[model samples]
Target: MRFISRTSSDGVTEQLFILGEIPGVLWTPEDAAGARPLILMGHGGGQHKKAPGIVARARRFVTEGGFAVVAVDAPNHGDRPKTEEFAEVVARLRAGMAAGEDVAPHLATMHTFLAGHAVPEWQAVLTAVQELDVVGAGPVGYFGMSMGCGLGVPFVAAEPRVRAAVLGLLGVDGLAEAAARVTVPVRFLLQWDDDKVPRAQGLALFDALGSADKTLHANPGDHGEIPEFETGSSLRFFARHLG
Candidate 1:
């Protein structure tokens, strides 16, 4: 891993890092020393590691919650180059939609392909970050929604280091099996009137989680209209489990 640049303010230090093909940002409180709990954040599809929401959450975790935060771009998103599989999937989805054909299957296939690559990349980043003394080591947690949830479920399932998660805003198709494997405590968020994900599917996904300790926070809104108060709730959730 390599540090490209770092900026500090208000007691928080945000640094840009590159781990081979993966580019990420790490946020930590300047005064923090030794090992501290880490929260791995994932951004929604079409958003990069530096998306406003991701940055805000990272800052909140580091400064207010006293935890280190990291976020990396998912495959075919942000600074990563687009893959042939992703291009083909998008083309097929567009053609299918134009032809008045059901594109649900295409969407599922794309999600699976993305998640397959994303899980390992996340693992690689985790491994690389652990070697950096600045991050130290403690408990780890994850927070993401929508595409983040779709990929995060599998990543969390495969990674034992993660002890808690905040996931939601996704359908159950490609995620149910992985969700069944996640044994960590999770707080799943849902937008009750999501236009893309059906209510039944969202509920089913939450039910699939293997964790005995899981909570669902469903609010009235569309996919992008997540209530702001939920952010505070998630910060508390991470603090309780990972602090």
Candidate 2:
């Protein structure tokens, strides 16, 4: 159920897999011949890896930010088929959010699903980046958006290799909870008018962080249209800290 394609440019060939098992385009660079910092990408609820915003963001990471980007598809999303495991989690989270009950439990389930799936997908990616380390690219980073706030936060906190973090459209509890645990430098790009998650959530996340160096960048757009390259400042944050 997976379709894969290889695209090359300037001696760098990236294997783009339309993963049937997970339902997202897993892009892993080939012949990198060295270790490189990795960026694991995530999408919002009910959305796919092919969303224009997410795809464009990945492109920006590669072309401009000069990092390896693994754009992931969560369960029941994108080209991947839906399953009871996924549906149950989604429903539980939705219900929890609606009832104003604690959603931390459902978030745990979603994180487990993502981390488990990252094994095979991350394999192709690490292959390319590992060799590049001879020259320099150090530990990896997690840059996620929307639900990515949930998935990325847990993954980085559990994995000590994560040296930099970026999040967009983060929920209040998830962001605040993860921010407290993140020992690395973190940046949050928040939309002041985001109807889905609200701006206060991002502000709360920035404020909750125990890290000495954390940033919260607010813009005029809502959840939908973030200024392209909104991550320019984020990359700088990583450079100052992760470099």
Best by lDDT: 1
Error of 1 at 220 (Å): 0.3
Candidate 1 regions exceeding 4 Å error are: 96-104
Error in Å for residue 75 of model 1: 0.9
Q: Across residues 1-243, which tens digit of lDDT does each residue of candidate 1 receive?
A: 899999999889989998889899989898667778888999997899999989987887787888889999888999999978799998997898789775556667777889888889998888887776767667899998988898899999999999999999987887778899999999999899998778888899999999999999999999898998898899999999987
Q: Pick out the ten consecutive residues of candidate 1 with the lowest summed lDDT.
A: 100-109
Whole-model lDDT per candidate: 0.88, 0.64
lDDT of 2 by residue, 109-153 (tens): 665675566544544443444444422447677777767776666
Assess the local accuracy of residue 133 in candidate 2 as a C-alpha lDDT between 0 and 100. Answer: 41
Q: Candidate 2 — which residues are off by over 4 angstroms? A: 1-3, 9-12, 18-33, 89-137
TM-score (C-alpha) between model 2 and the true structure: 0.74
lDDT of 2 at 149: 71
